[model samples]
Target: MSKIGFYIANLVKRVQNYSRFKNVFLQRLPQRFHGAARLLFYHTFTADEKKLATEIESFRSRIPALTTDKEIYSYTSPHSNTFQTDEAGNALPGEYVGSAAEAHMKTGSSTFNGILLRRIVAGAGVKKILELGTNTGFSGSYFLSVPGTELVTIEGSDALCAIAKQNMDRFSDKHRIMNMLFDEAITQLLAEAETFDCVFIDGQHEQKATLHYTQRVLPMLKPGALIVHDDIYWSEDMHQGWQHMVQDPQFSETVDLFYKGICVVGNGSGTKAHYDIGEYLPRPEIFRKNW
Candidate 1:
């Protein structure tokens, strides 16, 4: 029965992917109906989107073997309510362990998600972006692909930060990489009175930390700014955190894409709403064989 469901889902995706009329219909639908459109339609990439995707993939291919082969330095990750507990059920600090390639493959956003990020920034005319996790700069590259955009990305591991800097250097000088914990970076930005058009929360996949960091960054977001949360369904705790966020009065609308979630700061609507589109869409593979 599950396999039958999977096949049916794939067939629906294929129809949506190749149907230009359906794409146009989805694009022309009223904003209020966007949730329904997103659930039933697959976005068709524009020429610019394809160009940026190509460039990002090209840059990814040229990554030096040394960089990809190196082992990531172990570092203490932020407290995660889901997995930070010890064998005795006491809470403890969690450490990161993986190779650079492994981290990029597992943690870095995929090309499909990157295209979605690019479309969001382009569609919203986002100028300034704050990214919580810089996993070798794969996703940051996508955000920076939009012309006249500026980014400030934060990463907890010094080793990963260094790698991200190297990768980001090929793209643009408009980005700043901060090798600090998520909270530290957010606090620094807040203290500087800085504001952003979009904030991408990709680090520290914990329920408590997700809510805390999001609340801390609210004051720094410009009016109508976007808040994107990655790995929303990573765990029961993370999903609960997403649910809590969507219910908050601070956001006017929230979209749940299973792998990631997005919240809009204001929509001029007094009521809050949540959209679940993951079930209708297929999850993109984490790694591309061509790259």
Candidate 2:
């Protein structure tokens, strides 16, 4: 059944890819074919990037499957909830157990997203990193894999924080897991006068909070620091937040990878570059930012 599901997923992806090729590239044959140039420029991953992706996959395979520490079937009671689809019809699998050890939970970020995070950390040469969300330490494992880097992650749930701590024990003291609300954690960091070389903002997907963090984290980032916002197209609010970030003067440049939007703080000359990942196409700002 899993093999069949894999085959079906591949078939759907190929169809989607071809549809995008037609709609985005072939539609503008009479005009100045910008889509082809953009595709050629961004779609080709480098050799080193491919190798790193393979390594990330290998590391992910070794990670253990999540299991609850409590007695069986406690979470199967009446109040379990799950997020099946977003407004854009993007669906996610997996049953979300409640916020307890007895809930039989299996949830975290995707492997490809984890690879992207790891790549950003390595590519940007970030020494001090901050993550707004620590979901079961699945992504935390990738962050800890890099040498000479210190990671500080904030999680609102104590149960999830406990699980993340257990998962990140291999890193010992290199990583700090704070079980606190996003605002509270950022307040503490602000009081400490902490600055980060790279920051992954995956918490509070709403528009106001997203903009708030984008602005709030600027003072906490070193010059040329990489700031990444996850789930760019998760909703209207998220898209609006991403748009605000792209247009913000503080982040002089950006690279939009659909699932995640990456921005840099520097006096860079070029404009915001948009690259399509999965089925999402680049927005018109890519050209306007350049022009």
Candidate 3:
């Protein structure tokens, strides 16, 4: 593209972003309340929480660089080139497993969730991590950001496995991407008596699969290990599974962060209460919930 074309493109993008902001935030609030709303949001967090929140935003800002087209093709393994493109010559994103777009579901954990996981690993002394649904290694990258942390991620799609492997190539020694079904990976790990300090479930979103994973990982957790469930309210099925998990006799504590859920495996002695930190609310509680 020429310089004029680039300029025009950036201008168009700026207009789109501004329109989006107006429609999503400004349109709902009266002009007189807009400034007060901003003040209220900023006043909701402490200094330390604000700092952590900034860090999360910083990390999120860099994610697109890692998943850019240049980066994807750079490491995309020799898998089948079956992804389809629209009439506009744009490639469509892949959906989850079993869907026609299974190879394209590159959406990773949200920035909030990534920061939450990082805090869990750092605060919980988590060294060995197990992740289900290593879609293109986006979340895997975040998990491996902690020093000395090793991630064992299970992804069923061969294309996605290869993509994740390539995406996480820098952390060669820190991650192991398995190209197999979640159940198979769990069964094999169970047979090997493998254990993990922290576990993240994000791949399959079905109630039965979520419950099944909970059952399998229960015996594999170290005492007092932390289990994080992604997309707890993604669907009625997921919500049902999360409700059952919070009620399970195994977890001593359970927290509902709206976007994700966390459970602690132990004597089941804690209050077993459910706490909700709204998605729009700053998530300082995520850092403290491990206790």
Candidate 4:
């Protein structure tokens, strides 16, 4: 899109977000206190949040040089044109041929999302995290930034997994990298009777797969555990899957941040609610980096 078009679209989104914010928070405050409340809600950031923001900014700045332009083969989803298949047309494990620089640029989460993930982990005090996609380990590093956090990240591509292992090693040694399909890794975890404080679903952006994996992992989540669904708006089907999750009885609360969706399991609130706070949140530094 052209720069003007992008600006216009963003302006429209901001207007809609303002309306939602007003309904969700401002309207509930006393009329005279609304201005003060809004200011406090958006302007204030905890010390941890600031620290995470700085860490991600510094980390992302070094990614390009670290990855360089080295060519590599990463896993390809069946939905992609490059996915491998047998002569009989049966699907087989496939590799996506691309340079490390291209893979990171195309697959890694943005700096804004990285900071958001880290802030959530730190705020929720997440110790054990199960990440479905360990694409180059960029986002996984953020999850591990919080002290004492141990991650079990799964990636289908061996090459990508190896890179992720190296990246995650920089943060902590308390992580396990599984270079296998999502279902396979999840099965192993379930068989081991493993449970997690948080689960990040960042792979298989298809509706059926998303729902299926989420249901399969339900038994492996601890009480009040968080289930984060990335790229919720990637496609109509993905959005539908996210909607289904929001309506599911297991989650006591759901939050839609446009780019990412979050669900809390059995929060014991005796009520279920969904919040759309993507545009409502402060993001003045989202585009600070040139990349």
Best by lDDT: 1
Instruction: Count clashing pairs, candidate 4.
Output: 0
lDDT per residue as tens, model 2, 1-291: 355774566455556666665676445332222332333324444475466445544433333444444432211111112324446432222233454332323445655666567666766677888998786676777677667888899876666676677666655469988877666677789999999988888865655666666777788986578888877766665676688877777775566666578788765454443334434332322211111
Q: List clashing residue pairs in candidate 1.
A: none
Poorly placed runs, candidate 2 (over 4 Å): 1-105, 267-291
Off by over 4 Å in 1: 1-7, 13-40, 61-70, 74-93, 98-107, 267-269, 278-291
Best by TM-score: 1
Candidate 3 structure quality by residue, lDDT tens digits, 1-291: 555775565455545555544455546443422332333233244355456445434433344443434233211211123334457433333343242232244356555555556655665677899998787676776678668889999876665676677656654467888877667787789999999987898855656666767887888896578788987766665677788988887886666655567787866465454444332343222221211
- Evaluate model 4: give its lDDT: 0.69
Candidate 4 regions with alpha-carbon error over 4 angstroms: 1-23, 26-70, 77-102, 267-270, 278-291
Q: Comparing candidate 1 with candidate 4, which one achieves the higher lDDT?
A: 1
CA lDDT of each prediction against the hidden true structure: 0.70, 0.61, 0.61, 0.69
The TM-score, computed over Cα atoms with residue i paired to residue i, of candidate 4 is 0.73
lDDT for predicted candidate 2 compared with the true structure: 0.61
RMSD of 2: 10.4
What is candidate 4's lDDT per residue for 56-173, written digit by digit as tens?
4454445556544476566543232333435743234434556655446456765567766776666667799999889878788888877899999988777677667777787899
Q: Which stretches of candidate 3 lie above 4 Å from their native place?
A: 1-106, 268-271, 278-291
Sorted by TM-score, highest first, which candidate order results?
A: 1, 4, 2, 3
